[model samples]
Target: MSEPTSPESNPHLTLVDHPLVQHKLTLMRAKATSTATFRQLLREISLLLGYEALRTLPLTDTVIETPMQEMKAPVLAGKKLAVVSILRAGNGLLDGILELAPSARVGFVGLYRDEETLKPVQYYCKVPSDLADRPVLALDPMLATGNSSVAAVDLLKEKGAQDIRFLCLLAAPEGVARMKEAHPDVKIVTASLDEKLNEKGYIVPGLGDAGDRMFGTK
Candidate 1:
């Protein structure tokens, strides 16, 4: 595995360079990889990415027994996290993270891009009413242009998501810069940092459209 890259003087971006994550990402990046395999690999890699993203979660001491005597053990502190998915492709990453955080509260925000304008348009959104208090982990598989991502984070902030983190499988430098500039307060976690996006707004050398590849569409 290679060392993770971060922007100069920027602490919000985190590239997950763990060996297992890199291996899974390599498998997913192959064009020959089947949809079933791609989906499975995404799930596996998401788990690894999620582990790193949630590494700094607050912990508290709790009383527990080891079948013999009582002992104080570390447990998650504060309210359960709000895991909000940016719909469609985001669900791929969401499923795996949910496995790791079974007790987290779930939410969904649906947005689609306009091919011509390259802007995000929201179609649907539903989140917890008291989202203001809990930490938020916004899940999305690809961070391409960052328009939809920034839009999604804007909506999350509007709904009172103060401490928010963005998690994705892959990111282009363009998208990372856009997100950093637009929502500097939100941290980004991704498995791989790929090259630039092509003329059509697709990340070059990316795993194709994450949604299409995961679902075997077109």
Candidate 2:
């Protein structure tokens, strides 16, 4: 991730507004939606968001032969992308993106928030060794306080990942602002930029605990 020249604001954030993504997000947000349905919708929506997240990946020409004739074709350049999920909830989005880019490298970072402090504590992390050679797409379902998100990126940067992007289902203004101040170079892609986070540090009117909702843990 490139260090942001502007510390006061973020110009890297992207809001995915595709109709299908919007519809799926709506269904997922409904209180009555079943666990199975919510998980399914998350996967579908992630596919759409993944397309947007990777839209600017570098491409190069490759020689290929078709039945009709031999010609040069545009193909992705550089090493395969590294997709790192921020653990449990991130896996929901990771699975969908894999459907779109099956050959991409995969990694995981496990973090759980300390309720009283509202800070992240890392428990596990295992990422590709060649992360510096490839662009990384970091997946997390919610950007609530942005602490965990920021921590995740911090570790990624420490691991030599220069090109990084964050994908989430919902984002709070507080979270976006925090990320801007911390990792200005990372672009954040989300389905909705919701209102402020509640007192306990959850996005208001946001889909609750993405992991629990997707895994039926709640």
Candidate 3:
């Protein structure tokens, strides 16, 4: 993946606002939303967002012999899709997308920022072979600093993934800028673009700790 000299110049960043998506996202953001309710909302939102994300996928027509006659049917063109979740938090989005596109291949990447260096270190990674031949969608819940997200995409590109898309529930402006500067080729699909990150590295006004909220860990 090529680094972007200026992330602000990238034109593929998008925010989706379908009625169902907007409504569910609101509930997810509410403080009163319980863990069980949050998880359910994330799953539902993921499927709705996945629909919008895959809307432009290319299709090719193939002639098929029907019982009565021959007809052309449309089928997805190119290699199968790959859904790579960025672990714990990303898993919430993954569940719903998988429900919508069960045939898509799945992969996982686990990374945690080192407190001392503030850099991402991979703990686990397993992607499908021939990544360059497939369209890859990477999912995560929050995009705060974008360090992990950018690093993950860098690794994916190193592994020969050419077509990649990043999906998230919420994003901070700084995170967006960082990802745009680091990986301009990747498209971002998110529900909301919040303000800057606070000193502690959380998205200001963001729903706190997506993983904890979704899993009710604390």
Candidate 4:
């Protein structure tokens, strides 16, 4: 796929503009939207995005017996699905996706960037064994500088997750570039692309800290 125009450009992003996602995104963007409302919108939008994310999941045709006769049916192929959330914020998206794919195994990775160093340091990391055998969907709310995200993906790779995709609510141009440079094989799905990251490494015009919004903590 071609690269996105810029960190601020939404044109290159794989945005699921379905009505439900758009509506909730609007609510999430409003300044007056309450913590409760933001949390709800995040869950709703995550589910909608998850639907699009899983569209290309591999499937196999199997013989099945219906009420009257045998028929061929499609079922998810091979290993069960795995959802790896990049900690607190990713958990918001993870919950919604899990509701839709409950059979999927769950994992968590916690890394926080050091503002001064612009590097990610791991605080917690845990993922299911045998990730190489399963399709893994890794999630985080914002892909800004890409430092933390790249680190998260590196950890996943170390664990042998070959089939991995990155999912986010918003992405910045710089972050996308960093991810593409570091992990070109990973597919990215997001709702919108915001302008470049601000001096503090936050996505411009992007939703604020997703973890804070989701948990009602500053």
Candidate 5:
């Protein structure tokens, strides 16, 4: 998520093309990948994506005494980070990120897309306090049509989340464009930006439905 190898127009978007990430993604993408394996791979890849998402977090040096000597150590600064998942499917990514930031303030925004319109419908939303003070990480595995993502971000901003970063495994160019147009200030970190979304509003050349694959529901 550090470089822009794909659509270079959007400065806020990051495509994580590291070899390890790509390797795991390929496995997850295959039609034969099982539910248990897909879940595990999502967890593993999320850890990597989480690493990149929080890469620019501010650090402050604090005095600490080591066994050898007293020294200053760099640690996270400011308010604790707020990790908000766009629920259900988002939980897959959330579990892995929580492992990275165990103490991070967790939140959820439940939004499901309307099948016919591909529009987001809010069912629930509860986020951390002092969102303006924390760096919010809003996550979902797929950024397909971007409607859900934009709606989610709009909700986050309404709750006073000024510093927000979006995390996803796969993104469609349409989704990226919509996010950029809707919230230019937010950064998008993803493993891959696939081709356009399909007629049914699914990311084409995409890894099926992330939630279904992760849960074996479909």
Candidate 6:
């Protein structure tokens, strides 16, 4: 995929309009798609999104030995990355990103939204101690209300994370607005910016509850 398309509403957001990602996302959105297929498609799309999210990672010049002779090479600079999953749904995207970044340090922040208020409730959080030094990628399949996502980033920031990126399969305008208001400094990488959220805080025209479909849960 080439550079992501930045929307006028939020320049920090990058819409990954890659054809392959859109095609797989369509399959995943179909009501008839199987659980196994949805999971597989999510994994595939995660790799693509991950590619865009880390596209601007800093690089440094270094001397390397080639098959013939030594030469100057550019390589990834800075500390190992921290990939933080926002509990269950985030794990779906986490797997593929880990495959793309095998050496990244993994972390998890458990937060479930309250049905009535749609606010996040945290239960668990265990992240890398060096978050202040390493970049972080926070994962959640749906950026619905951006409640849980904002809460997750709050926790990461409290833990000393300076650089952070939010990753999702689909995002709604309300959620994106919420994220922008709460954490404008963080960049957002998503597959598609869909219509507004429904009355119950679900993304309209979305592929249903990502956690349930991905895990065969409700």
- Clash count per candidate: 0, 1, 0, 1, 1, 0
Q: Tens digit of lDDT per residue, candidate 6, span 71-93?
A: 99998899999999999899999
* lDDT by candidate, in order shown: 0.89, 0.92, 0.86, 0.86, 0.93, 0.92
Q: lDDT tens string, model 1, 1-218?
A: 12323555468888888888988898999999999999999888888898888988889999999998999999999999889989898888887899999999999999999999899999999998787788899999999999999999999999988989999998988888888888888899998778888998998788899999989986
Q: Each prediction's Cα RMSD?
A: 3.4, 3.1, 2.9, 2.7, 2.9, 3.8
lDDT of 1 at 63: 97
Error (Å) of candidate 2 at residue 113 is 0.6
Error of 6 at 42 (Å): 0.6
lDDT of 4 by residue, 1-218 (tens): 33544534432246666877777887887878888989888988899899888877999999999999999999999898989999879988988999989999999999988989889999999899899999999999999888899999999999999998889998888888888778878878888878788889988898788888789897
Error of 4 at 217 (Å): 1.4
Model 2: per-residue Cα lDDT over 43-151, one tens digit each: 9999999999999999999999999999999999999999999988999998899999999999999999999999999999999987889999999999999999999
How close is every model to the real structure, measured as TM-score? Answer: 0.94, 0.95, 0.92, 0.93, 0.96, 0.96
The best candidate by lDDT is: 5
Model 2, position 140: C-alpha lDDT score: 98
Which candidate do you rate higher for TM-score, 1 or 3?
1
**Which of 1 and 4 is ahead in TM-score?**
1
- Tens-place lDDT per residue, model 3, 1-218, is 23322234557777887888889988988999999999999999999888877776778999999999999999999988899999879999998999878889999999987766667899999989899998899999898889999989988998899999899998888888888878878888888888768877888799988999999999
lDDT of 4 at 201: 92
Clashes of 6: 0
Question: Candidate 5 on 118-213: residue-level lDDT in tens?
Answer: 999999999999999999999999998889999999999999999999999999888888888789899999999998778999998999999899
Higher-ranked by TM-score: 3 or 5? 5
